[model samples]
Target chain A: MSIPVLTPNIAAALAADVYDTIEMPAGAEFTPATGVLKTFFDFSRQGGAIHGRSGGLLFRRDSGFAVIGKGKSLTPYANSIAIAFRGTQTGYDWLSNTNTRTVTIENQTQAHKGFYELFKSMRPAMEQQLNPLLRNNAHAIVHCAGHSLGGALAQLAAIWIKKFYGNKVALYTFGAPRVGLKNFALQAPGSVDATYRCIHGDDPVPLAPVWPYYHAPYNGQVVRLTADTGIRVSSHKMRKVPHCYQNSARGDWANLISRERLQRQVFLKREDHHKVTFSEYWMNQIWDALTTLLRQSGGASAFVFGLQGLGAGVHSFYDNLAIELEKSGMNQQHSVHLEGLLACMLAFAGKRVIRAIELTARFIRWVFRQVLSVLDRAVRQAIQQVK
Target chain B: MWHLQRSTLVCILVGLLALFTHNPAEAGMFGWFKRIDVQVSPEIKGAITLHDKPQADMVIKRGTFFEDSWSWDSTRTDADGHFYFAEKTVKAREVLHERQVAVRLLALDYPTKGDEDLFFRLSSSHNLKSRSSDLLTDGMHCELSAEYTMSYLKSLEYPNMDWHGFQSKCRFLHADKVIVSQAELDAAELEETWRGIHSLLAYITQNASEMDTDDFIRFHVRSSAESGLAMLHKIRELETDIDKLNTLPNFEKKFQHYLNKLNKEDQR
Candidate 1:
């Protein structure tokens, strides 16, 4: 059977569920009565993406789970009890789960290693916090979502919940890497459920665990969030939060007009065409220049090329142009638009370049500090020889 | 001593770049609309071979960038085991794009031995150049490598059905009119639109069990409204499997007919 596509509105709602958990402080306590993001009868928060730990925080509100992010709407996934996962966090990024990329699982019969490992880490937390909630809301559909590694964990977790509870599980992962082999995705018990992996304009996490390891073996549908930084694709791992960016990723995808109200009218009447904006042209121009610089005959060029090979597929840069756009209000188009989509993608590419620059600057400073003493001694030794 | 050649330095800088890389945990996604022309021509004149023998045929299964893989087009080798097929993809055109294709090495071994259909996946194979033209040539080469190990049934099968592609095209040929699923009664939330769709849905649902699959496909598909109401009726009346809906005979011709009817209705 063909899988249904999750509209941007539905994805936005699920993003809230995951975002609430990611943004909530590590020490915060959650209960259905005191949910972190939504205020329902049974709202609460749990889990964290600790460095050595496998689990990340998840928020629950009544049958639905959420985390702290700028989510304004909630009706799309109303009946579904959901959990969101964070892609990676500072320091403990390695612990979330790592892909072996061999396309084979250790048990052979079981799921892949990365998924299995992540499930092992998250099981304890979910058993304590989420299992009971699942028990109480047995009638509710299980919804799991995350961006990047959190997405892989969600795939594993959904499989487990479906197995343990015999309930319908829906998965929505964004920019998620390949969790297991194609067979694992194809034949895994609940792999054919209502799963979606939303991708933004060239966000590279979805391309990970490379070659042979595929992201869509589960046959989970793909949704494209064409909105730029005005919509939050990188907020999970974006580092410039200190730069004062408001309106979280969830907030960006959430429709200002609710789905239920809009459902009463024409919803998908205009499937607009994407226009090639100036920002997109500018991005290519910049790419050409950077490639020129990196293509010069040198080991550094090859190394940089290798480094770029890791994640750089066109719009792979790191910067806070999202903040600048937000501040300028140029990024604010509450609904998905053809023009806005182009603009968002253009700005996103620009921001990536900026991020690369910022990271390079910090590295250069550290390298200078380390080499200063060594250079001084070498100069003195040379002078003594000359005397 | 640092071998500080420009290339070496560039490599060093690149390695350093990895340390600062952070996961963009929070992500945004989009569903792309694509129209591509897929052309398959062997690098040499011969068909792909296994164990030194020329393989008999191949099947090309088209899949979206993410979800359910469907057979878009297929071609079999000639007597010399050399074949080429090119097509403009309108398969699942009503659906979103961002698609990829899988080439299955069809071995016409007697009784089709142990290892079924071997599929070599070509990722991001089709890059549609324009929306206006479906003839956007995407040069996709299928390199049959020894690494591809998993096997599958060459064709998707249903209980009383031929191959999915065959059944779909055949039904399209035999039927006078065709109905494709596009219009949603559920989406018709306006009072008049909703009432129209709801009544149609209810009428179709109530009496569907007594209807015949062949008769329903032939008769209801040409409904006056030209909506997918008749197709829905066919499903309800015949208790037809959803997967069997599109596997009609002469699918492209019927699809174009359905589109033409939809266009004509809109004009009215």
Candidate 2:
């Protein structure tokens, strides 16, 4: 993949493309770069349990960072992918992610935990998609970037590409807040020479989560938007993006966040409050219930093949319950209490599996709470020691 | 009225004033109406533990999982490999609006032996009696590695697994369904190639609207860095149309229906 030299204009434009892609509906079949596309069409996403990883795969990718792989299994187009992430809206997810303090990334434990979930989640797909692509394409390069939270994701995505997939990545982050610990910058993927970070004037988002949230040193080129063309962090407005410097690219950053592109946010419309039918709403509710039950049930369901809606409700319920008890740590006191309650419930199930379904969802949750209440103080004290 | 004692009127007025200005210490007067912050105990503390022979690092996701979304609160295990999210005390009103929150996890990479990356999911709730939840038991480490990915793609291709058996296996009534048939895998590979062709056809159909081969080539060119607005629209239109027909219960059916329609058009 051919990427122009890491110029301010090029960085801003790439960031804008990502922002533009973010404005489009996820899974929209778009070819991002001339040789690499940012999104893919997954049939599994249509009916399966929402893996939550599907949507973020769409959008403006780091220029050369597009992963093209034809696995041992032939499906040329299916195998070729670019690891792009969607910027989650400014809501509870963003709040929770930003406030999540710190998390341990792959191979790094103890003192090496990085900050942010949205960034962390970008790791696996990047490895899986890019590893094969890098192996297959000798001239391949990973160009990573995003706008706002997308920028944060791009930072981590490029970091992953640099670390595991080899040193062929160019990273450009626009309006991105600090990602990961201060140390992440010290040994992050891709050198600062190949990285460029841009933020618009008075973009309040970059100054978020305050202290304890550290941005690794921005060693690469740093550009701030000029006062005349100032922008905010969450600005997806389609306008001309002006470079802070006189020599930045000719393209406007607004081209990425344009009004027409924002039409992609249709799927996330909260305005559908008046339009939902009763059945549609309840079906949604039931589907949610089944999916939740399945997650809490087991380590087993994680490996199970697809068995979507209206089909595996009853079975998923029991599987979820059985696995929770088996694989979960249950913590000493909590374990005994759970076992007693479960044993009692197992007796009920022996009489009728249907009886267990009601018990498993409601009764088990109640019992779990009762046990944790007794153990909360202990857990707190133990956790405090670690802290 | 005049004969009534002025002293009585003054005393009654004082009493009314005292009652209206209730003491601040007495539960803030209107505090009973105010919702208290109720504690939500976690039902699952799912952790993805990393192993490197010497020490294990665990990663945990603390989030309120919903039907179509998740609000994450991530945490890492300390030097000793202990990880847990601080239990949240949510407002009672917030609890009233929702039922339960989920914590699901998969390993980043489990280098330690015997410490396989176990897919885990858990829920937390404050108002447990209300029984509110919206979780789908899908996507826990679904896009694992190359083999698993292939296995998954092939399953979609062949479309013949014993759902009841798979369900039973999920429910722990049966042994693991780990061994996928070679025939099935091969069939899936072929189907995947067929799908690739189908996608190419769809790509052509979407781009043909532009009526110029150069523009179309530019649209499909993955790396030609022009603002590909036209390309984005064409792709969105085609995919959005299919997504319209796609549903949780009948995704395959809807997809096949459109595929059939496309196939029919080509014959015409």
Candidate 3:
């Protein structure tokens, strides 16, 4: 029996349809699902306290839904289940998003502490709804999808469905922030059969929870929608705007354009770093260079994995990265390049830096904070425009 | 014979006056013959309330849009907070024209002293001459605390197209059949007006083979920018808070800059 391939247009439409689960009144019978989904079921709920300190999870209600229906127009499988999670809503979700600490999940895979806890809160409700549906139809092809912060939860859900149910799982996420570290990214291919990571070219949400945290399928193949170069708050909107994700994801997957991973490492020269214009390309290149520099220090493992959940580990990581770059043995040229990268980053935050100033861990951390502050403001502004 | 000559002279003068006043290139030469009087707004009896209590002695204003012109009228609620507006009939040259009507109920000197604010609004629109049966069901019972609702309707010009303007937000069943605020409806109409202008520009360009495409686009872009700036200035005048009006000029400048950039791209 052949499984149906999810096309870009259908996946995009479904990602939008899932929002109806959040908008419509509770206990209201949803209008029939779109695309491949025939019947609808709603498990959406509003409030849940984030139990970050304790591992235990409790929720007043569920926050997503599952649709059991046929695949495409015709398929050999008896049933196909498409599970969708709702995006950030309450203040607690925002709090969870900012709590970027890491936690070890099953199989030693490290996941974002906030996202993992969100998934844990809804896991029981999801299982209660999915188990019976799957039991009746064992060969169901599970498709999990979400947008914004919900996309992070959907990724975690996809991994769980694949690990426990032994089903052919496919994942789709739009404008989702980073979920886990390098090891978690590496496990995507082994778990999910296919992943469709779609992002607008100017969306700022996907650029967050910066280095040491990574998006999965690990290879960085994103369906690049529109060629808009600079970040704009309006670009993150999911509606009918031309450069938005929903608008750009209109055509078939076969016809869509994909930006492949940067194969060769990008090393910045003194001139290149000083004159750097802020763009997604430059941001990725700089982070990649910083990762390479850390690796060359022979402490990549210690920095990436060893400091997984420590409270002050985020500051420690940046400080160590600065210290490593400052070492003469790391590379004479690397130190100059590091200074250039810091200058460019500071410039992006609308600040100028002097090379004569000591490259202390505090200064490096402040630069990161300023850059992240800009991104946080952009994300908040985008979120306000959602309705 | 002198009486017959005099009547003939009068007829010729009338003809000359009509020809000069109604140019075929602009208004239709026989516009009077096509003019029809229609009931553009229905008689509506409404009551205003704040926290479910009657709001007395308040002035309510209703602005009606028909035949591409706006007319305003104001009424005051009686001691019982009840008000009534008789049906409005207006002359429309075309039968298929849009009608928009909205009531502004401003509650002043409550919640804080010297603070005047608009408390509730009820706006609706339809293109067809005949009225929507459910436009004002059970009349209008406007609650100041109720959340605003907006609904989309099919386009009058392009019915096949999805999500055209004329949204209504009055709290009642079948509210989707009408529109919300007059300001929003006007904005939507402005979009359609621009769309029409662009279509006319395209038609003219297509027929006039000798016209330079760059020059034509440049002219339209400049005209649009000027018109948009005028509209923004008018809005700023109507706006009360000078601080909030600061963004208008900057927005217009960006809009003009963007249009210029587009013109340049087209030239390429």
Candidate 4:
């Protein structure tokens, strides 16, 4: 018999249950909750090895867990295997989330440094538990689901499961941050059989690791619910709040809004660039503008150029971008917009420099560094909540 | 020889006096003297209630901040469900800084209980120089049924601060009438509107359609009309919310005109 297909609502419930297992006591059995019928593999014993010590006054219990279970009849998919990963639960986890450094993976793809580290830590245990279940049932479908940071890990797991086990894999993530860069995001359609990326309009998690990093099912449609006008930290929460992913993920998937082609941003005027406030719409436009300038400067290779090699990092990449924008005499509009963008960054940092005079390339780079540092602090505080 | 001996004795006396008075806590050799300092928390007078009734004999736990650590104290409420704590002071060498003090009334655990079930929780800073009012010192009447109200603390000394995590379940009797924020009002209204939309969409599909010999051909047309009607109703319900905001589109009027046009088209 064929395996039962999963719906968006069921997938969201499974993802929320992953948090319960994370908080479960060590050596406890994986109890059947949403869709899971029988406990196939519970890596709760390896919980100690993966647990991180508390740092300073934060008093955090840093741990990550994944469970593999057989789906129940009522929930459907008796022949299916359900896997779920929990989101960031501790100070160390938040620390990892904020580490936006990139690392190159296979196929020249790059992923967020912290998320990759978390995936690597849990991969061995996941492989040990999943290898046999997958090998035994050649026809069994693997369903992976998670929320928040766990959503990013679920995406990575989908890629690995599809490649290694060569099984049919379905991936579902809610309010997940961008897991990797362009190449990594592009790899999704080829790896996973189906992808349901559910998100809230105001959710800040899905909007970040900003520019270079991208959400999977790249350029594909998303299940968008609750149309809040701007980005909100509270929207990143899964439960017990308004506009939360859990609350918004209700009802039939077909009834919900799904736009195949997302909204396009207009050209950034130099005069209005400095007026750009901290919002999802403006931030997306600024990121897109930067990406366009990079592509124009040296094709797609420009993105990967300064990202690698000695003394290379995100700072160097921005420095290179600033230099490109300064020297691009072919389009004076782009250069002027870049200057205005720098002024906006300065203004965001409480040092408003709205002069129309042309700024030095070095000064623009300096402004980028300052603004990023402020953003880093803001993210650190925001992560303590739902994001 | 007598003059040289007298000068050497005078120098030795001066050296002895300097060594006796030397202080390591001072900034430099000639630095000003440092003194012991004391900081006091604001006086607290509050009452705790559960389900609108006075909850007497409940343990009220107060955590007073002293430097990096907290000093905790516990007291039971009186028969009338009132609790009181005098001003708490802590002494330290050199200088003392004012800090936050929190109080919570713990509910007896019965299988499953959480922070939300607590009779009261309030946190406030003791430094009056920073803010003119104190939540604890004012007449506080806390009800367990009340939802936690969060407030942001902005300091003139530190501009650009946007922290908004402070929360309290108690009402200050001395305070002015509570002012609701526009953002909060909008969020509540939006939630209700979306909920209504969800139900209306479900109703349209379930009730407004008919099955023909083949399939429901008029399903789209009927659903569209129902959706428009729902939109008009939702807009009318929330019209007052956008009355003052001129930037917002007049969707209620637009939908009314569109529905009338649809009715005209049907007649034609």
Best by TM-score: 3
Candidate 1 per-residue lDDT over residues A47-132, each given as its tens digit: 43211144224421111123321111222223345565654432222211222313233324333453455556555556665555
Task: Write candidate 2's Cα lDDT for A1-387 as tens digits.
Answer: 222223344344344333223222333322222111112223222221111232222432221112221211222232222233334321222322212344544424111122244444445444544554577554344556555555666666666555565545666665555565435544553332255555444343443322223344424334445332222222321112122221233333333221111101111112222232212122233223333433444442353322221122222333444455455543454444444334332321121112223334455554333322222222221111111
Which candidate do you rate higher for TM-score, 2 or 3? 3
lDDT of each: 0.35, 0.35, 0.54, 0.54
Off by over 4 Å in 1: A1-7, A16-27, A30-42, A45-78, A91-115, A133-138, A188-192, A218-220, A227-387, B1-268
**RMSD score of candidate 4 (Å):** 16.0
Query: Candidate 4, after superposition: displacement of residue B245 in Å?
Result: 52
- Could you tell me which 10 consecutive residues in candidate 1 chain A have the lowest summed lDDT? A260-269
Per-residue lDDT tens digits of candidate 3, residues A1-387?
A: 123335554465455545444323333333322312331222222121111122224534443332322332112112356666555543333422345678887646777877787687766656655677666554566878777766887899889988877777888888888888778888877877778888877776787677677788787568777767666545664432334455567544546658556534556554564565555766777777666555555554345546545244344556565554444344556666666667767655555556564456667667767666555545554453221
User: Every model's DockQ, to 2 decimals?
Assistant: 0.01, 0.02, 0.01, 0.02
Runs in model 4 with CA error above 4 Å? Answer: A1-4, A25-27, A32-64, A73-75, A92-98, A106-108, A260-266, A298-313, A327-333, A344-353, A374-378, A385-387, B1-268
Residue A90's lDDT within candidate 1 is 25
CA shift at A86, candidate 4, in angstroms? Answer: 1.0
In CAPRI terms, model 3 is classed as incorrect
Better candidate by TM-score, 1 or 2? 1
Interface RMSD over true interface Cα atoms for each candidate: 25.5, 19.9, 25.5, 17.7
Q: lDDT per residue, candidate 4, B5-114, as tens digits?
A: 99999999888656533311111212124323333345678888877889887767666543334466777789998888776655433211112333444444311443
| TM-score per candidate | 0.33, 0.31, 0.56, 0.54
By DockQ, the candidates rank as 4, 2, 3, 1
Worst 10 residues of 3 chain B by lDDT: B94-103
To one decimal place, how large is model 2's interface RMSD in Å? 19.9
Q: Estimate how well candidate 2 is docked, as a DockQ score.
A: 0.02
